[model samples]
Target: MATHVLIIGGGIAGLNAAKSLGDAAGITVTIVDRQNHHLFQPLLYQVAMAGLSPADIAAPIRSILSGFSNIHVLQGEARSIKLDCACVEFDFGVLHYDYLVIACGATHSYFGHAEWEEFAPGLKTVAQATEIRRRVLAAFEQAERIEEPDEQKKYLTFVIVGGGPTGVELAGAIGEMSRYTLARDFRRINPRLTRVILVEAGPRILPMFSEEQAGRAARDLEKLGVQIWTSSIVTNVDANGVEMGDERIQTATALWAAGTEASEIGRSNGMPVDGRGRVIVEPDLSIADHSNVFVAGDQACFTHQTDRPLQGTAPVALQQGRFIGKTIVQELSGKPRTQFQFFDKGQMATIGRSRAIVEIGRFKFAGWFAWVTWLIVHIYYLTGFKNRFFVVLQWAWSYMTFRRGARLIVEKEWRMNQLESEEMLVDTTDDMPR
Candidate 1:
C-alpha cells in the first residue's frame, strides 16, 4: 500500500506543507479545507481599508498546487480524526492515512461574550473584512443624513477594543483616510473631526514589543489624532456604543482585535488545549499519545528552552509547518526525527504614511525610516511578486495623491436579502416540482 498523508486546513501552514512536500518522495499527499481559496490573513486589514482587493490577497487552492501530480486538493470540512483506526473522517468520507497534519488556524475569541461579535467583529477572513468595510463606510453615510448632533458623534467615532497590531494598523489607516483621503468628500461632517479610539485592557499597547518601541508607537498614533485608552476594559458592547468599566463611550463602529482561540475541532476532539484553546504539542510538533496526528500554526503551542511559550506569528507557523513536512519525509525514509527550531524575524507595525516602528534584536528604529523598513518587509513577505508590486504602487499612490478608489460598497444588505429570498423560492419550487 502507498503511504498516504492527510493534511487538514489550507491556510499558510497547510499550503506551505503541501508545497514543501510536493510528490518527488514516494508518498501521496491530500490536502483538505473547508474553503476553496487560501487567504493572505496578514493583509486582511488592508482589504478592510480598501487598500487591496479580495482577489489580490486570495488565491484558488487548486491553482497554486495543480502542477503536483501526486497531490490532491479536496474541499471538505474535517469532522473528526479516528486515532485508533489511523484514519481521518470528513463530512464526505473517511481517508485512511499513515500520517496526519492539523493546521487548523485560530478564530476570534469573544472572551465568553460571544454576542459582542455582532457589534465588534474581528477581521479573520474575506467575508468578515468586507462586512466590516460595509459597516465602516455606511457609518459615514448614515451620519451625513442624520440631523441630531448626538447621533452624528456616534457615527463619526470608531472604537477599537484591542491595541494590538491589528487595532493599531486599522486605527492609523482610518485616521489617514479621515484626515487626508476623505477629508473634503463630506460636506456636513468634518472628516478631520473623526475620532479613532483605541482601547487596551493592558497597561500598554503592543505588549509583545519592547517598552520603548511600544511607547513610541503609541505616541505617534496619538500625534495622528487617535485617542489611546489604556488600562480600560470593555465591560459591554452594543450597537450604539461600548461600556468601559464605569464610562459609556458611544461609537458607530467597534472593532475586535483582542484575542483568538483554536478551532472548534480542537475543543470538540478533547485535545490538550491551553486556556486560549491552542493545542499543546510535543517537541516534534505532535500531539501527546497521538504520534500520528500532528498540529502546528496558531492552533498549536510549544515552549522554548527559556520557558517562553511560542507566540502565534506567521514565521512560527511557517517554520513549524515546514519542520513537520521534513519530519514526515524523514519518518517515511526511516530517518531520525528533528526538533522544531524557531527563528524570530523581528516585528514591525506602521501607524501612518511616514510613521512606523521596527525592532530587530537589540537594534530599534522609529519614525519615517522605520515606516519605510516596515513597508519593505511586508511587501517582501506577501505572496507573489505581482501582489507585492501592486501593493507597493497602491500605497505609494495613496501616500502621494491621497485617493483610494476602492471605497465603493459592493455588497449591500438589501441585495443579500433579495438573493436569499430568491434562493428560498427556488428551493421551494424544486421540492414541489411545479
Candidate 2:
C-alpha cells in the first residue's frame, strides 16, 4: 500500500512540500487548509498598501497542484490532530495518514493586548490586507468631508507599530501613496497634512539587519516623509489611537506589524514549543517522541544550524517544506533522514520609490540598484505566471505614474469590536477614491 502523507496549510512551506511529494512513487499526498488558495505572504504588504489586489498575490491550490495525480486537495480547517490514531479531525470528517506534516503557519501577535486587534490588524492573509486597505482609504475619504482641521488630522494620520520589514514597508508605502498617489486626488486634504509614524520598541528599526543597512532604510523612509520613532513602546491602543508611555498619538488608523506566534496547532498537541509557540523540532524537523510527524513553516522552531530560531520568512519555509518532503521519501526507502540546514539567501526590504537594501553574505547594498534587485527577485518568486505578469505590469505603471491602481475601500468597518466597545456603528461602506 502507498504511504499516505497528510499536509496542513497551503502557505509557502506546505504547498512546496505538497508539490515535492505529488509525483513520488508509493506515496499519496493529501493537503488540507482553511483557505482554498495559496497566499504569497512576502508581498502581502503590497496588498495591504493598495499596491496590489488580493488576487495578485493568491492562487487557487487546486490549480497549483493539478498536474499531480497522486495528490488530493481538501478545503477544510483542522479541528485537532489525533497523533495516537495518526488522523486529523476536521469539522466535516477525519482523515488518517501514514506520515503527517503540520504547517499551519502563524498569526499576528499583539503582545499582551488582545483588545487591540480590532483597532489595529496585522497583515497575514488577503482578508487582513483588504481590511487594512479599507481603513487607509476610508481614513482619507473621511478626512475629505470633515470641516475641523483637528478632526481631519486625526483621520489623515496613520500609525504603524513595529519597525521590522513589514512596518517599514507599510510606512513607506503609505507615505508614498498619500504624497504621490492621492496627493492630487484630494483637494481638501493637502499632501503635506498626511502623517505616517512608525513606532518601534527597539533602539533601531530592522533590528535583524546590520546598523548600516537599518540606517539607510530609516533615511529612505524619512525621505518619503514617514516619521521614524525608535525606542518607543506602545502602552495602549484605543479607537482614538495609541499611547506610548505618557504620549498619545491620536489617529483613526493604527496598524500592527509587531510580532507573530505560531498557529494554535503547535500547542494543541502538547508538543514542546518555543516562546513564540513554534513546535521544537529535531534536527530533521520532526517533533520529539513522534518521528512520523514533522513540522514546517512558521509553525516550527528550528535552531539546529543557528543560535536563534529561523525567522518565519518565505525562503526558510520553502527550504523546510522541500526538506520534509524528501525526508519522508527517505523514510519510505529505509534511508537515514538528513538534518535540515537553511541556506541563508540573505535579506532584502524596499523602503519606497527607488530605495531598498539587500544583504547576501559579505555583499550589502542599498538604493536604486538594490530596489531593482528586490523587484526582480520578488517577481521571480511569485507562484503563477499570470500573477507575476500582472504584478510586473502594475509595478511598472506605478513606477512611471506614481499611482496605486487598487485603492479600493470595499470594507468600511475597519474596527468592529472597538466600535462595539465604544458603542458606535462604523459605516463600512464600499467605495472608490474620489
Candidate 3:
C-alpha cells in the first residue's frame, strides 16, 4: 500500500516537510490548514504598521504546492488528533493516515490575563495585523476631531508591552510612522507628538540577545523617540489603557508582543506537553512509542541536542521540518532515522530603517550594514519570485520616499457588516431558480 502522510498546518515547517516528500514516488501528502495561504510571519509587523499589504507577505498554499501532484492542500481546521487510531478528525470529517506530522504552530498568549487581549492584540495572523493597523490609524483621526487636549493625548499615547523582537520592531515602526509617514498628513494634531512607549517586564529589552546588543538596541530606540520602560510588569489592562506596576499610562492603543503559547491543537490528545503546551517529541521529532507520528515547528519541545528546548524561530522550524521530511524518506528506504540537530544560523533583529543588530558566531555587528544584511536574508526566504520582486521594489521605494502604500483602513466593524450584507445578497441571487 502507498504511504499516506498527513501534515497539519501550512506554515514554514509544514510546507518544507511536504516539499521534501513531494518527489517520493510511493508517498502521498495532504496539507490541512485553517487558512489557504502561507504567511511570512517575520514581516507580519510590517503589515500591522501598514508598511506592506497582506498579499505582499503571503501566498496561497495551493499555488505553492501546485508543482507536486502527489501533494494535496485542504482548507479546514483539524479538530483533534486521534493517536490511538492514527487518524485526524477535522471539523468536516476524519482521515486516517500511515504517517502524521503536526506543525500547527503557536498563537498569541495573554499570560494569565485573557481579558487583556481585547485591549492589546498581538500580531499572529493577517486579521489581527489589519485590526491593529485600523486601531492605530483611527487613533490619529480621532485625535484630530477632538477638542480636549487630555482626550487627544489619550488617543496619541501608544503603549507596547514586551521588549522582545516583536515589541521592538513594532515600537520602531510606529515611531517612524508618527515622526515621518503621517507627520505632514495631519494638520490638527501633530503626528510627531504621538507618544510611543515600549514596556518590558525584564531588566532590559531583547533579553534573548547579549547585554551589549540589547543595550545598543535600547539606545537606537531612544533616538527614534521611543520610551523604553524596563522591569515594568503590567498589572491590569482595560479599554482605557494599561497599568504597569505602580505607574499607569492612559492610552487608546495598547499592543501586546509579550508571549505566545502553542495553538489549541497542540494541547490535545492527552499527549505529553511542556508548560507552553508543545508536544514533547523524541529525538527524531516523533512522539514516543509512535515513531510514525511526528511533530515539528512551534508545536514540538525538542531538547535532545541542547540544554534547553529550541526557541520557536523560523530557522529552528525550517531545520526541524526539513530534517523530519528527510528522515521519513530514509526510514522508507530501510535506513535508520537520525536524530534532528538544528544548525544555529545566528540571530538578528531590525530596529528601524538603516538600523539593526546581528550576531553570527564571533562576528557581532550593528548599524546600517547589519540592517542591509537583515533585509537581504529576509528577501531570500520570502516564498515566491513575485513576492521577492515586489518586496524589493516596495523596500526600495519606501527607503527612498519614507512612505508606505498599504495604509488604507477598509475593515472596520461597520465596514465588515456592510461587506457581509453584500456577500449575502450575492449568495441569495445565486440561489434563485436560474
RMSD of each: 2.6, 6.1, 3.6
For 1-434, candidate 3 gives per-residue lDDT tens digits of 78999999999999999999997979999999999999999999999998899999999999999999899999999988888898999987999999999999998789899989999999999999999999999999999999999999999999999999999999999998999899989879899888999999999999889999989998999988999999999999999889977789999999999998897776768888999999999999999888899999998999998869899999998988898889888899999988888999899999999999999987889999999999999999999999999999998999999999989886555664788899999999999996
TM-score of 3: 0.95
| TM-score computed on alpha carbons, candidate 2 | 0.94
370-402: candidate 1 lDDT, tens digit per residue: 988877877776777777778888888888898
Q: What is the lDDT of residue 346 in candidate 1?
A: 86
Q: List the residue pairs that clash in candidate 1.
A: none
List runs of model 3 lying over 4 Å from the truth: 414-434
lDDT for each candidate structure: 0.87, 0.92, 0.92
| Model 2 stretches with alpha carbons more than 4 Å out | 412-434
lDDT of 2 at 5: 95
Report the C-alpha lDDT of model 2 over 293-391, residue by residue, as the tens digit: 999999999999987899999899999999999888877889988899999999999998899999998899999999999999999999999999999
**TM-score for all predictions?**
0.94, 0.94, 0.95
Poorest 10 consecutive residues by lDDT, candidate 1: 408-417
Pairs with steric clashes in candidate 2: 412-428, 413-428
Residue 163 Cα positional deviation in candidate 2, in Å, after optimal superposition:
0.5
